[model samples]
Each structure stands twice: as C-alpha cells, then as structure tokens.
Target: MMPSPGAAQPPSRGKARRGRPPAPISPGTGPSHRAWLEPVRSELFTSGLTLDDLVDRSGYSKTRISELLRGNGYYPAWELTFSVTRALGLPTPPLRRLWTAAAREAHKGPDWIRHCIEQVAHETEGPPLAYRAFCETLHQPYLQYARAFLLTDPRARGVVAETFDILWLSWNEAAASPDIRRYAWRLLRSRVMLRAARHQDGSPDLRAAVFSTDEAHAVQDPGHFMALTELIDLFEAITRLPDDQMDVAVLHYLCGFPDHQISHVLGLTPALTRAVDHHARATVETLLNAPNTQE
Candidate 1:
C-alpha cells in the first residue's frame, strides 16, 4: 500500500544510509526543469521518505532514484518519475504536465515524448482531455502576458508554470465553471499580479523607461522628452482602465495578439473584445489629452 501523505514519519529501515542528499540543482538548469524538480524535492523532505522506502514503494533501485531526485545524469523518462511521484502521493496530472514541459526543454523528441507518455497511459484515468488541451493552448500566451507584467523572463516563466499547476489541481472545479477560459485566464492573471510591482494607487507599475531608446538619444532629441512623457501617461492610463478593458488592451496592443486571439485569451467574444479595446483607447486618450493644472 502507498504511504499516507500525512504520515508523521517515514517508516524505519535497518542500518544503512537513507540516501545521499540530492545535489544542489545546477545553476544552468532551465526554469521548466527546476520548477518540477523543486516540488518533487519538497515532497521528499516533508514525507520523510528514505532511499530504502522510496525504492520499496517505487520498485526502482536506490542509485537510480537518487539520480532522479538530484536531477543528475540523463533526463528521466516519465515512467520513473511517475513511479516516484506516485509513491510520494503527488497528484499525477500536474506533475505530468510539469514533466512534459521539462522534457521539451531537455529537447526530448516527439517520438520519445509520446513513448514516455504511453508508458504511463494506464496510470489511473488521469485528467480529462480538455485539461490537457488547455495546458497546451494557453502556455505561450500566458508566458507572454506574464512577462509583460513581471518584466523578468525567469519570474514570468515561474508564474506561468505555477498557474498551470494550479489549474491542473483544480481542473474539475474550473471545467465546471460557466466559462472555463475566463476561469483559467483569471487564475493566471491573479498569479501574475501577485508578483508584479504595483503603483501607489495599486495599479501595475509598468516602466515607461522600457520604451526609451538610449540616454544619448533622449538628450539629443528634444521631441523625445514629449514622447516619453506621453508614453508614461499612456501606461498609467492603461493601469487605471477597468479589468476587462485593461486585459484586452494589453493582450492586443502590448502583446500584439490580434482581436481574435485576445478574445480567446480573455474569454470574450470577438465583438466584445473589440468594444473593450475601443473603450480602453478612448479612456487612455482622455487621460493623455487632459490639460496639466500644475503647469
């Protein structure tokens, strides 16, 4: 029988080293691989499972399990990883998606990916097909939107990865919602916003400096001053728009997603997306065109 997730302590084994501690993950490891490895390690620590217990539960040798846990040697196929995760009582679907992402990062070929997946095909029924489809469909746009808000590639990838895991864990509830796209999009947005820097008024702090050419250019061209100021005001104005309008504007204008894509991302109809985009532009224009009382 599998050990309970809430087990107070891992069962004892006769005198033998539990397992060599997992080596520190290499700094050059890609973010996708690290994301999955981190959670597996956490589960190992909290469960108090030793190498012996894991070998018994997972039917793999201590050396192989050690390598898998340390993320050393060749990238593991899903079969071994699934066995370890199952023994540790981690949810299968989320870890599977995470493993898939890491595998792709490792440059594992499609045939190999399919083979690894097929090896685990009979492992429980797994999540619904729709859930898997959503993972594939939303990943890139989610990453782009996250980077636009968070302004760091690793941080953005981290947020997107976490969002997918959360969605995987809550797939049933999310799928049952009136609008799955909207539900998933909002969940992703919440994760991104949690890590984003905010203005004093609680708006997202999008840096206008990101648009600047260079210090020399700014000094050489007097018109650059006016353009920079207007850009800053425009970003601030975007931050103040209502949630739907702001999302549509950013996904459309900032991310360069077409109206149809923005509609798909935000779960709005194309017509509604266009309407929101129009309102966002009008609102921003009004904010920018307003006279300066301080001058």
Candidate 2:
C-alpha cells in the first residue's frame, strides 16, 4: 500500500544480510517521479511546508503531488506545480527543463503501443470485422486523446484496449448510444482513473528502452547533438506553464480543438479559456526569446 505523504512511515526493520550488498537499483521501491523534483521537494521541506501544506495551495490532492514526487503516476500539469513553487517562495528558474525531462522519462507509449499493435494485428487479422470495427470506430482519435490525457501513464494502450473490448462485447449498445465518442471516452477515462488509484511499488521498471539516450543520440553526431539538446530544452520551457494553459496550448495548437470544444471538454469559461491560450502562447514566445538551455 502507498504510504501517506509527509507522514512518518513505520520502519520496516529487518536483519541485515551479512554478505550481500544492496543492488545498485533496488526493484522493491515503489513509484518515484522526475530526477529534479527531489531537490525541489527538499527545498519545500526547508521552507517548512509539509505535504499537507501543499494541498490547499495547489488545489490538488496530496496524493497527486506525492505521485509527482515519487514518479509513479502521470506527469503533472504545470499550473499546479507552478502554484507549489510559488507557495514555497521559489522562482520558476529552470523547472521547465526539469518538467520536460519528467515528460520524457514518463513517456512509455510510442514503444509499448508499437509492440502491442503489431501483436494485436497478427492475432486479430482472421476476425477483421470485430477488430477492425473497434479500430476504425475509435482507435485513431480516441487513442490520440488517451495518449495525450494520460501523459505519464504507462498503461494507456491497455486501458484503451480494455475500453474497446467492452465496446466489442456491447456493440449493439454502443451502436444504439446517441454519442459513441463521448461514451467511449468516458469509459476509457474511468479505466485510466481506476488504474491511477492502485498502488505502484516505486521500484523501477528496467524493461523500457529509452529514446532520449539512444534514438536522440542517433539523431545527431556528438559534435551536433547540441541542436537536439536545445529542442529538448524548448519542451521543458513549454512544460513550465500550468496545466490549464498547457492543455489549451496543446489542444489548440496541436490537437486543433476549437474554442468551443476545448471549453466544453475542459469546462473552462470561454473568456478564461481564451486568456489561458493567450498566456500559454506568450509564455512560449518568452521562452523562445531567452537564451538556449543545456543539460
């Protein structure tokens, strides 16, 4: 079970092994978050705010902030994080870069889905009707949104598949629904949240192949890697914005969601939503105007 944030956990004292040394990376520790957040959390501790203190300030649950620190959950929206920084009386500094690094580390989809899709296709080819129906109806758009929504979740594809599997079993019900997209999205979201509720041992999953160190390196030679590095830096800057602004930026700029739909989905007032979008754009512009960042 996950321990409560900032509460003193009972010590699990045990007899030490006389000869065996601890592994370089223990597999038993549960989910932890970004590499940079530890220092940030320490700074906050120095400021004398317990995890409980952060709840009211960030308007997010203590568990969510704890998740961010522990790196077991999804990458956080920037607004809430920025609120914590301000509450702790810290300047924004280079946190955006840190945020981008967190995003990169949190990313697990592109590879996992690649493997899963191929495997599924091979198995489902003979019964293309049911499989193809599910895919053609919901896969592309819904999968794209799920990938975006659960930015830090490693189980997005599985959740999406499960949602569709339900739809497959209830095709008549799905067809009868007045709004299939909404129904499917709601189902997928519930599944994602359910997974989020479960405790994850902070132990590292060693199986993932990292792209930043491998493919990113392949994008440029040692002498030219600076360009790739800078691009990464830009992403960090974008992540510095709070989630509302970030969501607006992503939905508007990337996903091409219009004002009304974005407002509808996010439940933001129209004027406020526009303001958030403007603020998001300005932040990006300011970041671009500044000096380039390095590792």
Candidate 3:
C-alpha cells in the first residue's frame, strides 16, 4: 500500500553513518527541482534517517541516494524518487507530480517522463471531467501570470502544470470551499512564490532587468520607451508591497481583472478589493518617487 501523509510515521533517529557531508545542490539547479527537494529534505529531517539507512531502506547505492538528495547530476526518474519517498514514509502522489514537473524542468523528454510515470502504480482512476475543465479554463491566465513573474515560458508552464496536479489531489476540499476560485488562486500563488526569486529583504525579486534590454530600439519610439521605463519601476515596487496588496495589484494591473473579478477571484469583498487596489497604486507611486528602489 502507498503511504499516506496521515499514516503513522517512523520514529526519528540520528544518522547511522558519518563522513564528509553530501555535496551541496548546485546553485544553478532549476526551481522545479528545488521545489520538490523541500519536502524530501523535511521528511529526511523529520524521520532522522541517515544516508546508510536510506540506502538500506530504498535498496539504492549510497552514492546514488546522496546524489538524489543533493539534486546533483541527472534528473531522477519517478521510480527512484518514489523509492526514496517510500523509504522515508512520505506520501507518493504529490511527490510524484512534483517529480514530474521537475523532470520537465530538467529537459527530460516526454517519452522519458511517460516511461517514468508508467513505472508507478496508478493513484486514482483519473481526475474528473469537472476538474479537467477547470484546469483548462485557468491554464492560460495562470501561464501568463507565471511567465510574467518568472520571466521564462518553460518555468511558468511547469509551475502551472504542477499547480493543477496538486489541486486535482485536493479537489473535494476546494469544491466545498466558499469560493473554489479563491482557494485555487491561493494555491497557485503559494506555488509560484515558493519558486520565485527573492530580494535580500525576502520580498519577491521580479527581476525587472528584462525591461531595460533593447534600449536603443525602445528609445526610437518615445511613447514605448516611457511606458517601459515606468513599467519596470512599477513592477519593482509591486514586488516589495505586502502580500495582499501585491496580489491585488497583479490581478488588477497585470491580469487585467476588474475590481469585481478580483473580488471574486481572491474571495475579497468588492469594497476591500477596491481599497487594496487603491493602496497598492498609492504605494507603487511612492516607491517610484524614491531613488534606488527600482532594480
């Protein structure tokens, strides 16, 4: 039987083998890999399993296990990740989706991904038609928002795809919520922010430098030049705003959502939505006036 997250967990114990620690995950590793790594690391810490213990439990060599934990070398197949998660007493479904997304980020081909997935036992018959429809409806806007934030199409698509898979796993709770859209929106936001680049102060770093590229061409059209300049500054300011205000601004300005739609999407009252938008613009304007605030 597959281990459930709620299942009785193994007792924590200290490492059974000691030596120089595993190599750190390369700084250039993709966000998808980094995202999947968090829970694996947490489970390892919580279970207090050592490298030797994992090798014994997972039936993989010590070096392979170490490489998997550190996210070094090639992307892991679903079979290998599943074995490690099972050994650590972690749930498989969510991790499987995460691993799938990470595999795509690692540039593994579709044939390889399908092969990896086929190695695992089925979790459910399949997601319901309603769930599939909902996913399709949100896919474009979600991709657009993710792309704008991450500044890369591939990373955005991976994050959106992973978000949908995660939502499928909890569709019942989401459907029962007062506002399904709001619940799913929060879920997507959390996933995106988890993988987003951050400022030294820990706010999101939107990496607005892309706006400044092709300056010569942009300057040839004075109107376009001015707009791009303001846009870069505005987005930089938006990143530093408090979370609520930032979300409001992104949905309002970037996604082109009206106040009422933003209200529905975020489960906020119309009055509150307008108020948040007002505050967001006011703050952005203030930040724009402040020197050295824009990156």
Candidate 4:
C-alpha cells in the first residue's frame, strides 16, 4: 500500500543518502544556467505542495523520487513517469523532455548545468502538473504582452523563446488549478518589467522606435492604426507624469485589465485602484491641454 500524503518518512539515521554526491560546477559557468534554474526553483518552492503530496498522488516510491532529484537514477520508464505526472496534474510531454534532458546532461561536463539539473530534479519533488501549471498560468498573458513589447524593442526577442519555454513547462504542469494558473500571468508581467528595467538605460531609442508612425500602421486596421497612434502619443505624454499616475494609466488604458484585476495584480486595494485611475485621468488632461503638447 502507498504511504499517506503528508506522512514523513523517517530519515535513515547517520547514513549518507545513496547515489553519487552532486557535482560542483566551475566558477566560469555562464549566466544561462543560473538564469534558467532560479526561475524554476522559485516556481517550485512557491507552489505550496510538498514532496509527500507528490508521492501519494504519483504512486512512485519516495526513494525513487529522491534518486531522480539527486541525479543518480535514470528516469523511470515512460508509463510510470506518465502516471505520476498525471496524478500531480502537470502537463506531460514538456516535463518528460525536461526530465530526459536533465538526466542525460547530469553526467556531462559543465558542472553548473549538471548542478542545476540536479537541483531542479531534487527540488521538484512535488507532483509536476500542479506547480508547473501554476507557474505557466502566471506567465501566459504576459506572453502576449511580451510579443507586443517585442514589437517596440526587438532586443527582447532573445529572451522571448526562453520565456515561452518556461511558460510552456509551467502550463503543462500547473493547468489543473485556476488560481495558480492566473497567478502565472502576474508572474509573467513581473518578469517583463524586470527585463525592461534591466535594459532601460541601454536603450532610450527603443521607446521612440516602438511608438513610431510606421510601426503603428503595421496593425492593419485604419481605425486601429489611428487609435494606436493616439494611444502611443498618450503613453509618451504619460511618461512625463509622476510614476504612480503613469502606472495607473498604463494598467487601465494600455492593458485594459479590469480595475479589480489590476488591483490584485499590483497588490493595491480596489479603492486605491480607483483613486489612481482618477489621478491619472486628471494628470493626462492637464498634460494634454498644456501649450506645445501635441494632440
């Protein structure tokens, strides 16, 4: 019979867990590994599920799960892996591929990648779908926003594919829960902001380039084209306003998210969202009427 979920397994007293010790990566490893693993680990740790929960649902032995995480054991045969994955409510194929890649790479050079794989393998002891889906849902809408953001700043293109990979993995893994999935969208937005801030000083021209008339016409509807132009102009004007006002304007006008959703996304009370919107509208009006500002 399987152990009950949440039951703690007694640790083998004074014995080192079997399997090879985790390999240490060299000092010169690139940023890619750290960048990749950090997000993955963050998602798992924040997922709210535990290792025993996964074992209960997946029917895999705790020892096997431990070995997989340690990077000391081969991936379970396909059927078993699939069953556990489904039980955890994760998207299957991408995770299987992730597991395969991690297992294969664990034995190769570049200790960073190996270490990351081992860490992910270990840390991701919970059921895959629940946490992964949670992370994916948090990021998908922002994926759409990222695509649009890229239209203005092509430099963002490099990270786009990697971002999608993370989203995909999260989606497949966490899709079973609505709350977790929705939170994924919020996380995606946060990531975009981080990326923008990182590149902000380096690319002043990006804003002007993205908002240009030629770029506006690419939307293909004469009405939309005109609206986009106006919107872009308004957004530029918004930048001159105080930061809080600018944030409110962007959330309401640019993203079109409902006031309540925006409130939740920004961690503000609904009353604050309304107040911010009102202040932003007043600020925009003041800016629009000021002499020498274009309509």
| lDDT of candidate 2 over 102-179, digit per residue (tens) | 444566455543442233112111222754565665565445445544544355575566555544433444456775
Per-prediction TM-score:
0.57, 0.31, 0.61, 0.41
Q: Find the number of clashing residue pairs for candidate 3.
A: 0
Candidate 4 overall lDDT versus native:
0.48
By TM-score, highest first, what's the ranking?
3, 1, 4, 2
Regions of model 4 farther than 4 Å from truth = 1-133, 152-190, 193-229, 240-247, 292-295
Q: How well is each residue in 26-122 modelled by candidate 4, as lDDT tens digits?
A: 3433333333333333333344434564566557776765443333344334344444444444444455444444334344444544443343223
The top-ranked prediction according to lDDT is 1
Deviation of model 3 at 195, angstroms: 3.1
Residue 95 local lDDT, model 2:
45
TM-score of 3: 0.61
lDDT of each: 0.75, 0.49, 0.73, 0.48
Winner by TM-score between candidate 2 and candidate 1: 1
